[model samples]
Target: MIDMTTGNPGKLITRFALPLLLGNILQQTYNIVDSIVVGNFIGSEALAAVGNSGIIIFLLISMFAGIGMGAVILVSQFFGAKQEEKLRTAVDTIYIGMSVAALIITLCGIGAAEPFLRLMHTPEGATMEMSVTYVRTIFLGTAMSFGYNINASILQGIGDSKSPLLFLSIATVLNIVLDLLFVTVFDMGVFGVALATIIAQGTSFIFGAVYINRKIKIFRLFSHRMRFDSRILLQSFQIGLPAGIQNLLFCVGTIVLQRLVNSYGPAFMAGYSATNKIDMFVFMPILSFANAITTYVGQNVGAKNLDRVKEGVRSALIISVSTAIIMSILVTIFGRYLLMAFTQDAEVIKTGEEFIKRLMPGYFLLAIIFTLNSTVRGAGETFMPMLASFVSLLVARVPLAYLFNYIGGRYNIFWCYGAGWFAGSLIIVSYYLSGRWKNKAFRFVEEAEKPKR
Candidate 1:
C-alpha cells in the first residue's frame, strides 16, 4: 500500500527508521524511567528488585508478542498484494490467538511467581518480598501489553509506524510521572515500578485500539467474522511460533545468566541490571532499523519485486552496520556515567563500567544477526531463527556460561554474553547465507513459480 517497491530507499529508510527508533527508545523509557525513580527514591537493593527481573519479564510476555511478528508478516503481505479482506482477517485472528496466549501466560504467572523468585535465590528479607510483588504485578498486565504489541504490529505492517510512536510517547511519559509519584511521594517501592509499566502499557493499547477503529479505513471489526478460521490460524502459527520460541529460548538463557549473576551477590546483580538498561538504548535503534528492513522486504517480496527486496537489504546493511559502529564507540565512552546515573555505589559503578568495556565489541555482530534474522522473518521463514536460537541459547550460551563460572574464572562470566552474542550472530548469518531462507530454499520453487498459498 505504501509502494515500498518503488520508493527511493535511502529517503524511505530514514523516514521510517527515525520514528521507529524514537518509538523504541520512548518505549524503553518505561524501564529507564523506572530505574531512575526507584533507585533515587528507594535505594540500590530495591532497584535490584525491579531491575533483576528483566529477563523473567520477557519470558512471560514474549510468546504472545511473537504472534505480533506473524501479524506483521501476514498483514504486510496482504497489504502489498492489496487484499483488503485478508488484512482484516489478520487483525481479528491475531487478537484471538494472542488473547488465548495471554490467559495461559497469566495463569503461569500466578502459579510461578513465588517459585521463580525463590529460584533466583533472592535473599531472605524485604528485598525478596519486593521482587515477588514486582513480578506478579507486571505479569497480571500481560494481556494488555501483548494486545498492544499485536495491534501495533498489524498497523505497522500496513505502513503506519508513526501512529504507534505518537501514542507510545504519551503513554511512556505518563508512566514516568506515575513512577515518580508512586515511589517517591507514596513510598510504594518495587510494586510502584510494576504498576507504572502496566498502566503505561494499558494506556498505549487503549489509544492504539481506539485510533485504529475509527481511522484505519482498511480494517473494520466485523461481528460475523469473529469465529476462528483454522486455515488462517495455521498459517499465522507457521510464521509466528518459531519466532516466539526463539524469544522464549533467549529468555530462558538470560534467566540462566541471571542465576549466574545472582551467585555473585546483590551488588553484582544491581550492577548488571543497571548496565543492561544502558545497553538496550544502543540496541533499540538497530532493532528498529531491522524491523524497517523486515517491512520493506516483506512488502516488496509480496509484490514479487525480488530485486527491490535485495536492494533494500543492501542499503539496510550498510546503514545498520554503520550505526552499530557508532554505538560501540558511544557505549565504550559513556559506560561509567550511565551506571553512576542509577547507583552511586562505587563498587557497582566500577563493575558496570568494566562490563560495558567488555560488551561493546559484540554490538556490531549482534546488529548483523538482528538484521539478518528479521530479513528471514520478513520472507516468512521462521524455522531457521527457531533453530538458530535453540542452538545459541540452549546448546551454546547456557553451557558456556556454566563452563565460564566453573573454569573460566568468576569475573569471566560477563564475557559469556559477548561470546554467546558472537556465536549467535555467526549462526544466524551463516543460515541466511546458506540459502536456507531464500525463496530458493524450498525445492518446490522451480515446480511452483509463486509463493505457496
Candidate 2:
C-alpha cells in the first residue's frame, strides 16, 4: 500500500493510476472476450444478445456499485485518519450491506430478465432468448460479483490498488480460458460466457478474501463476526445514496438509448456492442486517473493537507487530459482494426468505425468532468457530482439523443455524447471553482478527530 498523504502529487497519482488502469483494462477484457468469442463462434446475433444483456446487467448492479464507491470514500478517509477501528467497522458494514443487496438483486434480476429485455425491444426470437438466458445466468452469481467488488473497494480504500489488479488478472485469464472451453467445446453459447464470468468472479473473491485475511494485518475477513456499525452504515448511505440515484438515472437513460439502438436492427446493435468495448479502452486511463485522484484527495483531506489536494487535482487533470487526447488519436487511427476483432461483418465494422469517429472528440470533455467530480466526491461531497451526472445524462444526453435521432436519423445519436459531457463539465468546473468542496473536506477532518465510539 502506498501513502499519498506525503509525496510528490504527480508521481504518486501516476504510480497509483497505472495499476488501476491495467486492472480496469483486464476487467473490461472479461466482456470483450465474451463478445469476441460469441461474435466469432456463435454469430453476430449472439454477439448482439450479449451486448444487450451487458447494459441490463450494468443497470441491475449500478446502484450497489455506486454505494460501493461510497464505501471506498469512507474507508479511504478512515485509513488516512489512522482510525483503525472505524476503518475495520466500515469494511465490515460494507460487506454485510453488499451481501444482502446481492441476494435481493439476484432474485429480482432473474425474474425481471425477460421483461427488461422485452422492454428494451430486443429483436424477437433467437436474440431475445439468448439475452434472457445470459442475463439470468449472470444474475444467479450476483453474490460472487458483489463479493469481488467489495473486496477490491476495501483494498483500494486503503491505498492498495495492486492487489486487486493481481486478483483481476487471475480472473481475466481464467475467464478467457473458460469462455473458449464452454463456448467451443460444450456449445453452451451465451450461457457459457456468463457462467465463465461468475465462476471467475467467485474464484477472485475467495482468493481476495483469503489473501486479505492472512496478509493484511489491519483487517481480517473471517476472523470476526461481520456486523454493521450503524454510524458508518448511515454515513455510507448519506454519501452513497445520491451516487446510487445518479447511476440509476444514468442507467434509465441508457436503457432508453438502448431501446432506440434496438430499433436500428441487430447488425447495428452488434456494431454498437463492439464499439462499446472499444470505448472502454478509450475511457480506462481517464477513469484510472479520476479514481487515483479521489483516493489522493481523500487521504490528503484526512491528513488536513488541503494544499496537496489542490496540487494533486491539477496534476491529475494534466495527466488524464493528455492521456485522453492520446487515446482519442490512437482509437481514431486504428478503430476499424479493433472493430474487426469482434467480427468480420463489413456492415458491423463500418458502423462501429463511424461511431468511434463521431465519439472520440468528446472524450476530452469526459476526462475533465470525471476528474473534477471524483475530486469533490473524495472530499465527501457526493451530491454535487450526482447532480452533475443528472444534468449530463438525463437532462442533456438522453433528450438530445432522441431529438438528434428525430432530426437526422440513427447516425446522429452518437453526437449526444458530446453535448452531455459538455453539460457535465460545466457543473463540475463551477463546483470546483466555487471552492465549496473544501468545506466538506474540513467537516471530515473534524469528524476524524472525534473519539472512537
Candidate 3:
C-alpha cells in the first residue's frame, strides 16, 4: 500500500488513478458485453430490457455503495493517522453491515422486481418479462456484488488501488466468457447474461476474500473473529447517510429519465443503452481521479498536511479535465463506430450518435464537479457533496429533462445533463472556495487523535 502523506501530488494521484481507471473500464465491459450479446442475438427488445434493469440494479446498489464510501473514508483516515485498531474495526463493521444489507436488498429486489419495472413503465410483453427476469437473477447475487465492492473500497482506502484492478480483471474476463457461452451456445437470452454476471462477480468476491486473508498482514478477514464497533458504525453512517440519500435521490431521478426513454420505444431505448456503455468508458477516468483524490485528501487530512490536500486537488483537476477533454474528442470521432459494434440497426445507431454529440461537451464540467466533491468528501465533509449532487441531479437535471421533453420531445432531453453538471459545479466550487471543508477536515483529524476507550 502506498502512502500519500508525503509524495509529489501529481505522480501519486496518477499512480493511484491509472489502475482504478483501467478497472472501471473493465467493469463497464460487463454491461457492454451484455448489451452486445443480447442486442445481436436476442434483438433490440432484449437489449432495452437489460438496459432498463441495469438502472434499477444501480439504484439499489448505489445507496449501499454510498454508505460503503463512509467505511472507505474512515479506513483511509485511520490508516493515515496510524490508528491501526480503528482501521481494522472500520473494515470489519462495513463487511458485517453491508453483508446484512445485501441479504435484505436481495429479498426485496427479487420480490419487487416486476412491480418496479412496471412502475418504470417498461414496455409491455417481452420487454417487461425480460427486464424482470434479468433483474431478479441479478438481485439473487447481491451478496456477491456487495462483497466485492466492500473489498475494493477497503483496499482503496488503504491506498492499494491496483489489487482491485487485478480482482476486476479476473471478474471481467470471466463475465465475458460466461456471457458468450450462456447467451450464444446455451441460447439462454437475458437469463444467460444475468447469470454470467452473477457467477463472475461471485468468483471475484471469493477470490478477493481469500487473497486478502492470506496475503494482507495489516488486517485479517477470516482468520479472526469480526468485531462490530457501534462507534465506528455510527460514525460511518453519519458520514455515509447523506451520500446514501443523495444516491437514492439520484437513482430516483434516473428512474424518471428512464421512463422518458421508455416512451420513445425499444429502438431508442436500445440506442440509449448502448450509449450508456460508451458513456461509462468516457467517465471512468474522471471517476478514477475523483477516487484517487478522495484517498489523497483523506490521507493528507489524517496526516494534518492540509496544503498537500489542496495540491493534490489541483493536480487531480489538471489530469482529470485534460483527460476528459481528450475523451470527448475521441468519443465524438469514434462513437458511431462503437455503436455499430452493438447492433446493425440504423435507428439505434443514429440515436446513440445523437446522445454522444449532445453529452460529450459536458464531461469536463462533470469532471470538475466530481473532483471538488471528492476532495470535500475525503476531508469528511460529505454533506456538502451530497447537497451538491442533490441540486445537480434532482433539482436541475430531472426537472430540465422533463421540461426539454415537453418543449422538443425526446430529442432535447439530454441537454439537461449539461445543465445539471453546470449547476452542481457552481455549488461545489462555491463550497470549496469558502474553505469550510478544511475546518471539517481539521475537526476529523482532531477526533482521530483522541485516545480510544
lDDT of 1 at 327: 88
lDDT of 2: 0.90
Q: Which of the two candidates, 1 or 2, achieves a greater lDDT against the reference?
A: 2
TM-score of each: 0.93, 0.98, 0.98
Ranking 1 against 2 by TM-score, winner:
2
Model 2 pairs whose backbones collide: none
lDDT of each: 0.77, 0.90, 0.90
Q: What is the alpha-carbon lDDT for the whole of candidate 1?
A: 0.77
The residue-by-residue lDDT of candidate 3 on 1-453, one tens digit each, is 989998799999999999999999999987798899999999999999998898788778777888888878989998888888788878888988998899989988899888889888899999999999999999999999988888898999999999999899999999999999998899998999999999999999999999998878888885467888887787778778888888898889999989988889999999998998899999999999999999998888888889898888999999999999999999999999999989999999999998899899998999999999999999988899998999999999999999998998787888899999999999999999999988777565566567778
Q: What residue runs in model 2 are displaced by over 4 Å at the alpha carbon?
A: 448-453
Candidate 3 wrongly placed segments (more than 4 Å): 448-453
**Least accurate 10 contiguous residues by lDDT in model 3:** 442-451
| Candidate 3 C-alpha error for residue 341, in Å | 0.8
